[model samples]
Target: MKIEYADRMRTVGEMGAWEPWLEFFVEGIRTQAAEAVAQTNDL
Candidate 1:
């Protein structure tokens, strides 16, 4: 599923109003990934 960011945003907008939710979702994923890496290094 290769889609451009703008395309994805458009689709999401079409589905419903969720811009903030999407932002939080991406941020959460990033934070979790960073935490995972840090924990692995601490081992």
Candidate 2:
């Protein structure tokens, strides 16, 4: 995840590419939401 973040930041900084970073951020949010739902169900 650290490497992936670095790569994403590099693209955003070097090429002014926002889509990849936006996608990555959205996926991370989706993943966290899924985990939260699972944990709530478990509880």
Candidate 3:
């Protein structure tokens, strides 16, 4: 997903914006993954 996003950003000449967006994107994914694991543990 990060690779795909980087490719798109590069194509659009927005490479500089990648870092901030990636930080936010990764945090969201991590939070969701943690929640999913917790739910599975509960089951």
For candidate 2, write residues 1-43 as lDDT tens digits.
9899899999999999999999999999999999999999999
In model 2, state the lDDT of residue 3: 95
Writing each residue's lDDT as its tens digit, candidate 1 over 1-43 gives 2344566667677886477557756887899999999999999
> How much is 34 displaced in model 2, in angstroms?
0.5
Cα-based lDDT at residue 11, candidate 3 = 51
Each candidate's lDDT (Cα)?
0.72, 0.96, 0.75
Quote model 3's TM-score.
0.62
lDDT of 3: 0.75
lDDT, model 2 = 0.96
Question: How well is each residue in 1-43 modelled by candidate 3, as lDDT tens digits?
Answer: 6786667567557546666666767887999999999999999
User: Using TM-score as the measure, what is the rank order of every candidate, best first?
Assistant: 2, 3, 1
Question: Highest lDDT among the candidates is held by which one?
Answer: 2
- Candidate RMSDs in order: 4.8, 0.6, 4.2
Best by TM-score: 2
Pairs clashing in candidate 2? none
Which residue pairs come into collision in candidate 3? Answer: none
lDDT of 2 at 39: 100
